[model samples]
Target: MKLDFNLKLTQEQRLVMTQQMQLSVKMLQMSGFELQEYIGKEVEENPVLDAEYDTNSNLKEKNNEIDYKKFIEYLNFDNYSGKNYYRNEEETVSPFTFISNKKSLKDYLNEQIIEVNEGEYTKEICKYIVENLDNRGYLDNTVENICEEIEAKKDDVEYALKVVQSLEPDGIACGDLKECLKIQLNKKGIKDENLFGLIDDCLELLANNKLGEISKKLKIKKSEVQRYVDFIRTLEPKPARGFYTGENVKYIAPDAYIRKIDGEYHIIMNDDILPKLKISPLYKNIVSSENNDNDNDTADYVKKKINNAMFLIKSIQHRKSTIYRVLEQIIDLQRDYFDYGKEYLKPMTLKEISYRIDMHESTVSRAIRDKYIYTNKGIVKIKDLFTVGISSQAYGDDISTIKIKNKIKECIESEDKKKPLSDQKICDILKKEDMNISRRTVAKYREELGIKSSSKRKRF
Candidate 1:
């Protein structure tokens, strides 16, 4: 075989994202509070970017044109009122940031330990027990192990265990789920032998609804076992459910609001709380200078910064406008929902809104990403406007999946506790209401709402 070397020339057109375009896309996805934080960093890095405060209503319900430059002085601090950073003076700390005075789980237990009026050695043992509690309010160490560690007798350790377990929250310092249930039961003065036996030896059977086995073994009626299980459902496994989670509480500010003016609905951007961004006159003057063209690097550096600043300003404007238009379209489509209640919420999708507004679906997605708007129904995320719908043989738009799920939750909440409604029964109930959905979908929606099935929901 003969081999020949040849080179072929081919050309193709392709679209590439530039640095400015990338920044614009990134800014488009940032929320209102996140944009403020990003702008703060940008002000520190770029000398050409300047900010000002706009003395207007942070929440405006009027229809007015958004003048981004109206912001002259940025008074963005909300939680730190007494702190002085703009002027040279003493730094006044905020009381909300003082975490030392707050009581932790261990601190709370120790206070109760001191009130016990027990012996010094016993109190010390209880203190050790309290300190050894895990974040879930469970004692990870056994009494025997604690006794060996402190060189104390087993009786003292057992007493300390009981003392620590007697603290509030009903189940603190408990070693396991069984002990936790017993402690909470003790607090409620519940001493049913059937309930105690269920916790100790038949928890698995109880969960699977084999109460017949429990009734036979414990010599208690099946109805009584069912009643005990129902009570157990009310107790929490993790006693410290709402303790300090070591995370700052995030505060959200809606980016836009829907207002009614003389029986008209309008979508307006929330630009008052945001810091106003504009190019510095000093750098602008330098960039527009024609005579000082001797140095290329300096001119290039200034021009690059100027272009970046302008693109950033334009990107922010685009973000606000895009969000405003999205809210406008959503309000148009789901008008009945906003005017009435969630029951009127229709089936909607990003594709539908994007097609109506002549925008790419991804663009619409980015515009509503982590964005919120204030309606008469209070503040709601823009993403919630896009919901899956279930079509039925009825008038009006398709019923939203959110509405269906909410209805399922209502059915379960109001159902007879002795014989809870099954998924098929719930489907029939919805059919009577003109809602056509399958039993599998009902079960799926039930699970999404954090609800168990009829068997698990059964009570006596």
Candidate 2:
């Protein structure tokens, strides 16, 4: 009944993202390493764009006919906030200088295999087993499955499995956690039958710290069971934990550094990680020359490239400025944390920082996304500074979720081993301290801290 199409002109306000604007947002969200790569790609693609890898290098005059001062003024490199953004007297070392080759786990095993006096057939099977081993160094396939897949005898496969397991990283190629623990214990010359029994049958009980159940099952005294369990706890759960598992480790490069000097904290932007952006003089001349109207194609091309280069440079500056402002505000807000330590870190939110800096909450989020900052203690993710507030009932103040998690960790750490504190008990303790949190919330925070339940944390 109302199927009429008509053109209506109504005025409304809406935010439309242009290409440059989208690029600005992307730049803001990029980590320090990511921004470096993005800028590198841009330098390769855009003829008008040039990048100086040396941060300490001064601007050299190129193409004598062009005005160097005017060109420098046009690029605004001198006034850019990203250049020597922090005026700290002490020189900071670059983290990238220490990058070296990392030996993978498989490579380490293969190297040890070369020294073994085994026949080629057995060695081939050993290699196959090594290849099949998961990142945790556990042999995923059974001997029967290996025999079926490789068309080898079960005996040969078992022998090969033994050979692979005997290599360095003592617990390698184990079928399960129990086998792994036994191999490590046997290698360490621990020949206690009770320990072997505990590994075989009481692993679940051991995990829950149920020494009494273990003692009852093994017909041993509770104190003796506790001693054995304590020794067994030192075993490596994952054999491949410290070795490279063929995955490239992505290193975090801090965008800025917060250091304490004299009596005040200072923010030092990491300008070395990024290459300095500059307009190529050749392209600049082409864009600046006025008498080239006859060749509209080349002029338009150069002008477009110049516009793109300028926009890219502007976006980078905006990204740096936004991140700097956000970090500056964080330094101000979390001054106590920097002055003292993590225990003094105040609860902060993106909305609070956004209001303080007169920017939208989303902008603040993007500004800190995938960004990291080096502090006096260590490198920390910028987002980690912003934690959701948990209201304190006693003083009517808010506590950071991070603080609650820390408190939970402390409670579990200092708890009596014989009678561990339950989640409800922890909640009650926190409540007594004026932190109003439910038992469920306590459990959630405990889990987030990678802690086990009270039953699992308990000892004999």
Q: Give model 2's TM-score versus the native structure.
A: 0.83
* Tens digits of lDDT, candidate 1, 212-326: 7878988888888877777888998888777764457565677876777787798767786588888889877777788666876777887888887888889888988888788
User: How many residue pairs clash per model?
Assistant: 5, 0
Each model's C-alpha lDDT?
0.80, 0.84
lDDT for 372 in candidate 1 is: 80
RMSD of 1: 7.7
Deviation from native of the Cα of residue 106 in model 2, angstroms: 2.8
lDDT of 2 at 147: 92
Q: Which number leads on lDDT?
A: 2
lDDT of 2 by residue, 275-358 (tens): 889888998788678878888799999889888989988888898899889988999999888877787778899989999999
lDDT of 2 at 237: 87
Query: How does candidate 1 score on lDDT?
Result: 0.80
Scored by TM-score, the top model is 2
For model 2, the stretches where C-alpha displacement exceeds 4 angstroms are: 1-11, 55-101, 142-152, 188-194, 209-224, 390-397
**TM-score of candidate 1 versus the correct structure, residues matched by position:** 0.81
